[model samples]
Target: MNQIITFGEVLMRISPRGNKKFIQSNNVEFYFGGTELNVGISIANFGGDVKHISCVSNDFIGDTAISYLRKFDVSTSAIVRSNRPLGVYFLEVGAVMRPSTISYNRSHSSFSEIQPEMVNWEKSLKKGKWFHWTGITPALCKGGKETLLEGLKLARKKGMQVSADPTYRSGLWKYGENPREVLSELVNYSTVFIGGVNEMNELLETDFSYSNEDFIEASKQLMLKYPSIEKVFDKIRTSINSSWHKIRARMWNGKDFKETLDIDITHIIDRIGTGDAFAAGIIHGLQKFDDYKTMEFGAAACAIKHTYLGDINYANEADVISILEGNTSGRLKR
Candidate 1:
């Protein structure tokens, strides 16, 4: 019975309700989203003892975020309140060769101001078997980097397993530090590592050709470079357009690598947060089962995420298991 703890900032995502652009739409739909928070919520929904630790503003948006987390039964006692505003991001999903663009307004966010003293590392991490985080947390600012380092140190001292997603967002690293410098340092503490090949190459300063064997080889090389990492997981996607894509995933569990067959997605309701969903699935599968078949479960969860709007909360274990059983016809239920 291992408990999972996630540390990061939660943001209010404002995206146009439909296909309308930001300038054309007078109103936008609001959803609570953050890398670590999204994963924690999904894990909690799947009936895991999960907790989210972060700083939030004492504003309407922050209050709504707390309420939303409560709806999923996630613990918020570790959250700190501040007068600073919560971070926000605007998303404009694109079609064809144009990729989605996200504009972040996260400067001076409450989480960015978090200090090492704000977290009771001993209590929050007590009895915790797993600690999760992302590259975005360390990229926030000087204070954020320091806070994450402290959390990782405490986790290591307590002998808790650590996982990290080097989710590279180029725009988020503006603290006068190169992504490679910051990410490599943080990744040194992770036991489970997840990220894209592009991100890995950028951080490691090497070029890797894409192939199943090459991917696994690169991951093994990375594991050797960082002795703390015992596993590496990645999602592979082929986008045909904004609405359709083919996706699969792979994992390296210290000794060998395994991959899942590609799934052809017909319609994508929302492309955001699918990666986090995949990460949640991996965490769930690794914690519950001992087989490589968990890779298929994780990939199926990501496929289901593309068919839904908003964040990872809408995903369910049944849907993922169904997909894993090869039910891609998507027949409606009564």
Candidate 2:
């Protein structure tokens, strides 16, 4: 398999132990993650060759962050060091009937201060077969937006597969760029759409209700508007509470529409990076399976992430295959 390229910020997540809120705990646990970085690390855990490109602080924190990626076998050769400090987010993990909350402090972080001239997209993407990015990258600053666009244009020119996950967070779009306009332009260069109806409505600026029929219609219109998108995959989450949820997926490959059985996850440990796990699964599965099976694999990967305590899904290919084979019972392997 060729290299998979992911471009985004690298953040340090600080959370109180267990389900304790900030006021309840004096000490906090920290882990490294970002939207696109989570996907890259998860794909690497599943035996995919992945490279993550980002800018981190030129300090001990950044050194440890790079080491963390290396621990997961994620190549960080393209990662640069800057004088600005790394981005940080405080996560308050919640229990049943209470939802998790997050507060980000990344305005002047290293990744947000990156420039297009800093990275050579041609050399960075030379050995890559697939490239992945999310909406959070461009929403950081003008420089971040310009840097990502440079990579996207170069990837498109090289005929590499591009996966676009437009995870629109209204609070992050304070950089004065129109979210719809910027996403529409970038998504046009992508070959796969890793989002659903709500994301489509945000980009198309249309009102479409959440229904299976509406999803198909929305996907059809999306592809018609952006002809480069070859397929669409969506991970649907039905939350019963903060601790329990069900994961499923649906896909439209321009010819067929397929859906997967729900993978119910009870006693969720962490749900922050589950969507990124689904995206990584789809990217990995598409290289080995058909569209329907690919969506099923994505849902399984997502459900498995709830059992872990960090932002990256540590499940291997065999673990996901175990889930696929209907082994939901958490029995001891020994």
Candidate 3:
């Protein structure tokens, strides 16, 4: 079995139950989530060998996080323990016309202060055939960026396939550096890039008009800048309301462009980790199916994620494949 190694932070998410506002809520729920952790769990749920590497405090909260990962059958041997507090965020779920809100309190978390030498990168990635991370990891802090870079470099050294989601969060990069400059170095070794036009303009400093033709042109320029990239993929959404969305996905493999038909997602349960699910689905599909089929498979994976309640895509391979085959009748499987 091929092993996929993912690197990032595992965070504690506190959310107000129901549609209540944070200010009015007296009760809150705790859930575990992180970009790499979400992807690792998704791949593992599809029966893939996936390992996740991150930093965590040697405390009960960290124990709970590890337990969550173990429940999903993701390997946590690469996790480094320390005394720093765990990264946490509070979520205020919204509805209809209101927008979802998030307030992060993750400054100086264990993972934020992670150093490159803290882990044996070679050992952690020894059997890894695929390595995955997101732009959010680098945006955490300067040390986080360096640690991620070291992992990327080691993955390249061992001839591993690398993938990244250019998750540009405006608030996360507060460490006195240009995001474009920091992210470009990591993108250079990536084989699959999951991003879009605004991201290209922000990270690569390219003036893509964001039209289909210009998207392709931007992709071409991106490929020229980083020949290591094999495919650029993105999921597009047309919002009908805060609760309903018409979503599809597209991909460019440096030669051809592929897109999936828009599927309506009504009554979104949670929109947090859909992109990670898509990335995991594409990675899994690439290993088992053809290139073009991956886009459809990834889109299906993403669509199902919005129906779940948490950060990880709880849907398994059979469920995703059923949806991919156009059996979205939502009927009971008796």
What would the per-residue lDDT of candidate 1 be over residues 122-199, giving only the tens digit for each residue? 888886889988888988887788888888988988888888898888877888987787888888888988776776
TM-score of each: 0.95, 0.99, 0.97
Residue lDDT tens for model 3, 1-334: 2899999999999998987888888898888999988999999999999899999988999998999999988999989987998999888888988888888888888898788889789889888999998999999998889999998998988889999887788788998988888888899879998888877777667677857888888888888888999898888878887799877888899789988898788889988898899999989988999878888889999999999888989989999999988887799878
Better of 2 and 3 by TM-score: 2
Off by over 4 Å in 1: 95-98
Tell me the lDDT of model 1 at 118.
90
lDDT of 2 by residue, 222-269 (tens): 999999999999999898999999999999999899999888898898
Off by over 4 Å in 3: none
| Better candidate number, 1 or 2, judged by TM-score | 2
User: Residue 35 in model 3: shift from native, Å?
Assistant: 1.0
Q: Give lDDT for model 2.
A: 0.93
RMSD of each: 1.6, 0.8, 1.1
lDDT of each: 0.84, 0.93, 0.88
Where does candidate 1 have its weakest 10-residue lDDT segment?
Answer: 288-297
Candidate 3 weakest lDDT stretch, 10 residues? 202-211
- Model 1 lDDT, residue 71, Cα: 88
- TM-score: the better of candidates 1 and 3: 3
